[model samples]
Target chain A: MAGLTKQEGLSSPVSVSGLSYAYPAARGGNSRLALNHLSFDVSAGEMFGVLGPNGGGKSTLFKILATLLRPGSGRVRLFGQDTQAARGTRKRMGVVFQNPSLDLRLTCEENLLYQGRLYGLSGRDLARRVDDALGLYRLEDRRRDWAGSLSGGLRRRLELAKGLIHDPDLLLLDEPTVGLDPGARKELWDHLGRIRGSRKITILLTTHLMDEAERCDRLMLLHEGRLTAEGTPEVLKGEIGGDVITLETEQPDTLLAGVRERFQAEAARLGEHVRIERKQGHSFIPQLVEAFPGLIRSVHLSKPTLEDVFIHHTGRGFWNEGAQQESRGT
Target chain B: MRAIAALWSRELLRFFRDRARVVGALAPPVVFWFLIGSGLGNAFKMPGAAAGVDFLQYFFSGTLVLIVLFTSVFATISIIEDRREGFLQAVLVAPITRLSIVLGKVLGAATVGLIQGSFFLVLTPLSGIDLPLQGFLWAATAMALASLGLTGLGFCIAWKMDSTQGFHAVMNLFLIPMWMLSGALFPHSTAPGWLRFVMSANPVSYAVSALQHSFGMGSVALASLPLCLLVLTGFSVATLGACVWLARDQD
Candidate 1:
């Protein structure tokens, strides 16, 4: 453990500087940029999240860090060593891909054993590590069972166990809870928290779920291959400095103009909803209702959330925009 | 070395666990041997000097080569599956070198090919091919080398493909023809001038010639025993080298 900290003298666990990546043109389509001059640093033993929607370049970032894809430009350093030049860096990190990497036909124990050997673990040490992983993931009873036969949650646990078998100091997971149910997702988070507490490992995960992002110690919000915001959930939400108010109206543009002209408040129309971010939102609701008595169909006000922070920075509803982009096949 | 051993064992574990894959690889060649060998018996004759040598006996050696080919191709197809399902990504990121990954997979696939090819050896007596003690050893050695070469070739192809459909296309267009022209269907001496040229150049021809010489069933020698072994070894090394090169990066 002390030797592991030797590289931790004066550097963050993970750092990216001026990183950019572009996907090559496929067939007749033009090449698309996946990441753009992104830079961030993750402290040792911190749980960090890259929060984004589909095609937001989080996956590309994950690949570059995992050393699966070379960065198109710039550099990524893990534990003060450039990832491109450091083969030893790979030995110190555990990566869990978005898709399940388990060999479905093999038993839980066999999968871990094989993974352990990939890191040069063997003899009694490998056996003990495999046993410990099975026990820690609560997979002892199912050690002999085929991985494909396990329930979805158990299989995910086995994946985590395999990733941890070599006892990597840094763990990277890409969309770890994509297909998991709420209960399983929570359980997975709980396990992650426990692992961090016990081992002091640096855990970096990417997720599109706002609730999942809220659980991170720190998060960077990505949109269209750019970082929109970076901070703890509280700090990010706090940047709004007030409540978020939404007014449902049939004529959103008209109400938006009226609110801007009459009250001189900054308001934007998003679909059928006119949104305003302001301080003292509760008191403003009455003034808003009085100004437009028959026009305002409904009014909703709430404290700032991660989504509100996203909308404040990007000026678009997260889910709706994501859905629209997906439908258009962008 | 340890990584190679681990990956090799993993391949064996997965192959044995999937009963369907094991049966699928072994059963086809046996069926083809009995049906094609018996159906085309004595009706077929060679252009060279050997007479009264039944096609069943001649095709028995071909069936052995087919077993090796089918088993190797089917075994290496798992590489495509592993890539699509994300297993290859895990291996690619591991601390092991690409050479170890290639060696492990090629050896694993070769072992499957060897086991299936050896299983076909038990039926050689039924085809009336007498195997002397020394000849059986030579034949087994030839079978193993052929298996390694074929499996390495399959690995090279599978590593580049993302879809099983693409692999199937390569199998039909490239692998099957390679086998057909390797003196598996007919002797090189009987082939036309153009086809004879192809048979002589095919690496698989050396493997088939080695097997025929070991079995003492054919007088036609496209290449000598030492030359055949050298070519087969070169074939294995070249294909394995190609796999290592292709697997050096993940794009």
Candidate 2:
């Protein structure tokens, strides 16, 4: 519910206030609200992540920030200028969309050249910038190759290179690591971190993957078109204020009831396991085993993660809800 | 202006890089011209044909117009493809004006159509039409104007469409009929009163008439030479305006 501050001379790199959007009705269906009074601020030189599951309004927010969609209400400002009102704001910002935007028929260098020209860069300056980007992304060797011929990882790198060819102050990436494998994802994160370190540019990226969200300097959790939580990953995880304990048992329901009754702790049944959050969960694990000697089969004790923070705040598992909604074809 | 030039160059780069697209845009019209011209030449006769003039020779200017139509259509369809593939979104978010985007794309497509149409014009000798140097230059100018107008029209239609299937539907239902009634398929002199009226009303009729006059081919012109030129220029300006208007906002 806390909106970004509009204090004079205290402008953040990106700020949003009372942002909302709705998709118009399709056929017989009524209009659906995608974002509901969302607000947040991303500081300069910070890597901010908007974390959410599918249909959680991450893409809608991304579209609005990238200047592709007009918010139904409220305002978005980049560097103290209204995003919707100023064409100059777009010149200072770069956007990498969720979908591939590179023309596959053109070479890597050609794509960068065209992207540079869109931002009004041309001549030797444009050529030098294109070369710098190609080298920065380690795509110099593949500069002449068609974009379609590159692998997914290389194509993503090329996309990043093109996005930065104009030397933007703020770069918006919507799920930049969507289709990459684990190795490629890590490599991309490393490159992004390097870019932020060397260039001092602000980055805002959206991702549904909890691991990806953990890499961000600050994280905002969005669920069903509302801001659920916002903080550093560690701070958000610490919101639960205890360790998470999971116990595998023959009868999870009975074991959950027993734990709640005996330990006076809130325990929930999840599939074949009963999970509990409490202080000193490692010591409580042995006690739990002793209390349910024959019922418990296995136990797990670990620090809370971003996933746990999400569940603690929303009362549901992130992927499970998303998968169910997806299966229902919503 | 720089954005327009960049976008225009990008279109040409993509067009030339895809050899298949370049070949695809040029081949079908030539084959259509040959088959249809020869077939119709044997069966149909001109009502007031001069000695040594055949249907193949008479159909030559029409075939050039068909080439311009095909090339322009192929060039403009890339707009829909770019939108589907996300390239257009990237361009839309840039600092450039919407009019520049439309101008760049329309000019790019028009240039492609003009190039292909000129390539087809080289076959005038094959059709037994003797085009003098001055006439050839005029024919090229008329071809460029016609290409610009047709490509602008294609840009208008393609800007509103989301799918190539919808574009194909429009092409069949609207563009082909426009061409057929432009006296491209048959001379306006042989048509009935109502058909002649329709031909005179079609903008493309002036372009075809201008092209026919440039080639020194005897034909029934719906309007005088200066009048045809004026109409072609007006058509180009009007279609370009419509395209720019349609591209003003992202939906």
Candidate 1, chain A: TM-score against the reference = 0.94
Model 1 agreement with the true structure over A1-330: per-residue lDDT tens digits? 344456556467799989999999999999999999999988888899999878789999999999888989888998889887657888999999989999987888888988999999999999999888888888899999988899989989989988888888899999999899998898898899889878878999999999999999999999888999999999999998588899999887778888888877757667788888888999999999999988999999999999888877777777764221111000
Judged by DockQ cut-offs, the docking class of candidate 2 is: medium
lDDT of candidate 2 over B1-251, digit per residue (tens): 99999888887877887788888888987888889989988887777532345777767778888889888877999999999988998998898888999989989988988888888898888878889998798788888888899999999899878999999999999999998898777888889999999999998898888877877764555676678889999999999999888887545
User: Which sections of candidate 2 miss by over 4 Å?
Assistant: A1-10, A249-258, A290-297, A321-330, B48-53
Docking class of 1: medium
Q: How well is candidate 2 docked (DockQ)?
A: 0.75
Fnat for every candidate: 0.80, 0.77
Across residues B107-196, which tens digit of lDDT does each residue of candidate 1 receive?
A: 998998888888889777777889888788988989899999999999988987889999999999998998888887677887789999
The 10 consecutive residues of candidate 1 chain B with the worst lDDT sum are B42-51
Best by TM-score: 1
